[model samples]
Target: MSLNWITLRVRDLEASLNFYHDILGLPIERRFESRGKQIVMLGTGAQPKLELIQTIDQTLKPECGVSVGFEVKSLDEAIEYLKSRGIPVLRGPITPNPHLRFFYILDPDGFEVQLAEHS
Candidate 1:
């Protein structure tokens, strides 16, 4: 079976939207408000969508251990783009093997996001 979607509970919806949609350039597929909660779905093509939900009175801290990874066409280009945007890279641009390169960056809530390229 294919994966459906990944949901993340965000503390500040607007800031999260700016980070994901504006900075990272994930398009918003849809958004809705329900039960005093605001939710937004962002993604494109056939990949799994990312859902951001903001609930009233929610105060959950981001877990550092969990990480979401995205594949890129060029690791160097991706790293340059993030650096140009003033986004800090938390980890390596090291090659795990001759075929792969990766780096990590923290999201707005301090969630680890990995970008990798494979040859």
Candidate 2:
């Protein structure tokens, strides 16, 4: 089957929105409140690539060993932009090969986000 949207249970919807939408520039496809819960879908086109769900409990911890990766045009530029916004890079701009490079950063909810570039 084709891959569908990936969901993240976030502690703060507004903060997540700011990070993913305002900072990363992911457009909001749609958002709605249902059964006292907030859900927002974000992506570039008709189908949402990422979905953020508001957790009922703010103290719920995120699961470990999970990361979402985004392919970037330039790893250096991405790191610079993130640094300018005070977002810390948690790991390397490691080059496993001449054509590939990547780094990690934590989202507002402590989710590991990998930014990678491939030539």
Candidate 3:
């Protein structure tokens, strides 16, 4: 079976939308409400997408070990852009190899997000 979507229970819907859509440039595929939860799907028309769910209770503690990664055109450029927007890099521009580099940042709801570039 193929991966369809990864869901994140967020505390603030608007903040999450700003981070994913405005900051990261992910397009909002759709948004709707279900079972009293506001849900939003983001990314291109692809199988593996991001789903943000905002419930009435905004008590969410995101796991430190769980992080979602996205590929970037340039790691340095991404870092610069994030810095310009006042988003601090949580981790390094770690290079596992000569062709790959990545870094981590915390989302508005404290979820870790990794931005990487493969040269």
Q: Give stretches of model 3 more than 4 Å off.
A: none
Q: Who is ahead in lDDT, 1 or 3?
A: 3
Q: Clash pairs of candidate 2?
A: none
Q: Can you give the lDDT of residue 42 in candidate 1?
A: 92
Error of 2 at 8 (Å): 0.4
Tell me the tens digit of each residue's lDDT in model 1 across 47-88: 899999985545676774777788899888988999998898
Deviation in Å, model 2, residue 46 alpha carbon = 5.6
Candidate order by decreasing TM-score: 3, 2, 1
lDDT of 3 by residue, 7-109 (tens): 9888889999999999999999999999888999998975588999985566677774778999999899999999999999999999999999999999988
Query: Which ten contiguous residues of candidate 2 have the minimum total lDDT?
Result: 56-65
lDDT of 2 by residue, 22-61 (tens): 9888899889998988999899764538999999677766
Query: How many clashing pairs does model 2 include?
Result: 0
User: Which ranges of candidate 1 are over 4 A from the true structure?
Assistant: 56-59
Any runs in candidate 2 off by more than 4 Å, and if so which? 46-48
- TM-score pick, better of 1 and 3: 3
How much lDDT does each candidate structure score?
A: 0.87, 0.89, 0.91
User: Which candidate leads in TM-score?
Assistant: 3
TM-score of each: 0.90, 0.92, 0.94
Clashes of each: 0, 0, 0
